[model samples]
Target: MKPLEGLLVLDFSQFLAGPSAALRLGDMGARVIKIERPGTGELNRQLSIKNQMVDGDSMLFHTINRGKESYAANLKDSEDAASVKALIAQADVLIENFRPGTMEKLGFGYDAVKELNSGIVYATVTGYGQEGPWRDKPGQDLLIQSLSGLAWLNGNADQPPVPFGLAVADMFAGAHLVQGILACLVRRGRTGQGGRVEVSLLESALDLQFEVLTTHLNDGGELPQRSAVNNAHAYLGAPYGIYETKNGYLALAMGSVIRLGELLACEALAAYQDPKSWFTQRDEIKQILVDHLQTRTTDEWLQILEPADYWCADVLTWKRLFAHDGFKALGMVQDVGREDGARRLRTTRCPIRINGERLFDTNAAPKVGEHNASIEQEFKLRDAQPSVGQHQPDGGERI
Candidate 1:
């Protein structure tokens, strides 16, 4: 059994950050019930990647919302609101990503929620924090990256600032939210008192740059200098970037340039024997590597580098990586589909492992309000009164 097998999580959030946190708890074996709207449901049901959809919902939504139940309600309506409040009383955790004041306006703020269920782990995700000038700004991943100076850290120095191809702001913020929620849950387990977990894309973005930001803070407030040639990290030195080879690309991490020179037979790299020059003349050193690496194929370089304990690897495309046995060995992918087996989505599985067992769930995402009838029947929500909720753990090997 999974660690969260006894828990009930009410997901009142949409899109990536908040929803992904709920998704994680579900993966850990929580019975996650998504509180969506009546008709259109959450906004992400239509938010598509490559305009891809399966079974009338976006593949993006399928990937994130898989293995969860959905319960649709119009929170503005009194009957629906009261029914939801009943569910809230039963929930071990509650999550939302509405703007700062929205939850309070809806009478579901932390203060109000804790009154009903003092043990509820209230988790919130925002673009910015509740009290800030930027709080009202749309909590978008790109905007967070741009505003947080995260975008300024990518690409070659001459090139424009590049936001990550993936939604790092959303994913990291979600991961951080999970960390906080799990911590609060552990505390509640011991103390029988819950806590609030607040994470913002802006804060998570800044935290992602903690290493480089520390340098900026301590090194006389100097901004990062992106390498003019093949910049990988703004704060890193020579041979720290992905270089093109005869066939493909090779990534070299922090290593002795002299050793690399001897291995790859690039004599030019030997000149910068001074360790400090690795940073000072980084552009020149990198440029030398840029030109010399292309003379040999990536595999050829790997052949020379690997035997001598040099830190290097061949950069592979998704196609090559997926075809590799290394990727196959991880068992990272799984298929989830509807009950009828009419549709199936091949997506990534939960990354966590416990007691040497990998977690796998074949449960697919439910349609909007798909489980409402059953949930109402089980919880007796149609005529819910002010009653204490039940939480029974199907005994588990804690993860």
Candidate 2:
């Protein structure tokens, strides 16, 4: 049996961070029920990556939200809020990523939910922690990366700040939330009590740079100095960046500059025999290697350096990586189909294995409110009564 086979998760979150955590739980065999608005559902359905759409929803939504059931309800409506509260009473876990006070206003905050289900694992994701000046700022990935000082670490020294090409802040926060939730689940298994987990995009981004950031903090308050040419890491020394060869690029990791010069037969690199000069004169050493490497093809360099056990590789684009035997051996891709079997989308599978077997699931994301009737019947939520003073201006009722 899967680790989380009997657990139930209520995902009241949209977009990347919280849903991605729920996706990982589902991969481990949890039953996830996504609670969305009645008409528009989660806003992520409309948040497209590269304007790619599939089956009337964004491909980004379909990929992260696959293998889950959707229940539609207007949270402002007293009757719908009552139904959700009843469902919460039976759920093993609850995840939400609304702005800090939104859930508390709806009466589904950790303190409120703990009263309804004491053993529930409640997790929250936000742009920042509850009491910071930057808490109210939008929790977008790019904005968080900029605010966290991560953008300054990339690119050459002369270039403007460069944010990661992917939504790193959101994904990292989701992974961190999952770590906390799993830890709490372990404690609940022993203590018979639930706990709260909170993660913010800004915190996650900062944690991602702990190594370099720690160095910066202790090194006399000096800012990181990015290499003026071919900078891969802000703090690493010479021969630690990608270089353009005759036909393509080659990446060189930390290695002996003298040995590299010997292998490539570039006499100029031989002069920097002193190890300390590798860092102090990194730019000069890199410029010499760059000019020399351009004369040979990437394959030629690899042919010479690889057999000698040098730390180097020929850079591969997505097309080249997919076509390689190494990528195919991992079996990382899978096909998922909708309930009606009328549509299918190929996407990446969960990167995990249990008992020597890779986890695989074929279910696709549910359409808005697709499972409302069935869930209401199963949980007997329709018969639940709204608490006093639960009514609000919006159709939704307070918890």
Candidate 3:
């Protein structure tokens, strides 16, 4: 049996944060009912690139919403709301990402749901929080990065702040939601009562940068301004960045002060042997290393460094990483065939492994209302089906 075998989750969340959390629960064998809208379902369905659906599937939607049963319903309809309440009555958990107070206004908030199912664990994934100054304000991942001081620490010191390549805020919030839900589940097991758990994108962003935030708080130091715009480890000291080799690049992470002497072993890098010289004259040491690295190919450096246990690696692109032996050994990549007779479907698998076995199988993202009939039959909800409301002409206002 899976970890959360008998638990049922009513996922009334859209986009990334809450959906990702719900997917994690689903991975652990929770029965996830993804509550989407009547027409297009999740907003991610329209975020296609160049008129092409990413990955021959809904890329954004699939990443965080796999292994879920879709239930398309317009919550604004009173009858639909009643049907949702019925689902909630039998659910072990309810996860939502609506703007603060929106759920309460619709009469299906934590209080309302808990009244019916006292043991329900309600998780709220918001941008700011439920009752802050920005509670009702609409926020995206970009805004949360700025608010959490992450943007300040990114990019070059002289240039404008840079947005991260990934939706770090949303991803972090999802992780926090998973942690909160697990903790709440344990609490419920002990007390026989459910609890409310809140995870905010802003809070998650801040939490991910705990090292930077805590250092600033304790030392009254300002967040680090990046000297190198594209470098991954911007805050760290010298010898911890990408250096151009004869062909492509090699990344070095020998930045630990204690490891400085060990990393500067090359004859060309002998000048940095003096601890004071290395500490005070980082530019000089960096230039020497850069010059030496430029003489050798990345492969040559890898051959030398791989055996030495130095924090070094040849910089690899996506294609290289996909075919990497390390990931292959870990079973991080898997093949999936489609009914359309596609050549190949190489997809990344879930990371969690228990006793050397994968925790869950690859469950593809469902089509709109794919399992509606099955769910209705299983829960005897066919008789309780809601009359989903129609969208209005004036931008479809919520009820």
Q: What is the TM-score of each candidate against the true structure?
A: 0.97, 0.95, 0.86
Native-referenced Cα lDDT, model 2: 0.89
Q: Of models 1 and 3, which has the larger TM-score?
A: 1
Q: Predict model 3's lDDT versus the native.
A: 0.73
Tell me the TM-score of model 2: 0.95
In terms of lDDT, the poorest run of 10 residues in model 2 is 390-399
lDDT for each residue of candidate 2 in 131-230, tens digit (9 for 90 to 100): 8788888889999989899898989999999999999999999999999988888877776677899999999999999999999999999998999989
Stronger candidate by lDDT (2 vs 3):
2
**What are the per-residue Cα lDDT tens digits for candidate 1 across 1-399?**
887888889999999999999999999889999999998999999999999999999999998899899999998888998889888887888999998889899888998888777778899999999886898999999999999998889988899998999999999999999999999887777667778999999999999999999989999988889998989998888889999999999999999888889998988888989989999999999989989999989999999999999998878899999999999999999989999776898999999997889989898888999999999998888886534423322221132
Candidates, ranked, lDDT: 2, 1, 3
Task: Note the clash tally of each candidate.
Answer: 0, 6, 0
Which stretches of candidate 3 lie above 4 Å from their native place? 54-57, 223-225, 228-235, 255-268, 273-280, 335-346, 382-399
What is candidate 1's local distance difference test score? Answer: 0.89
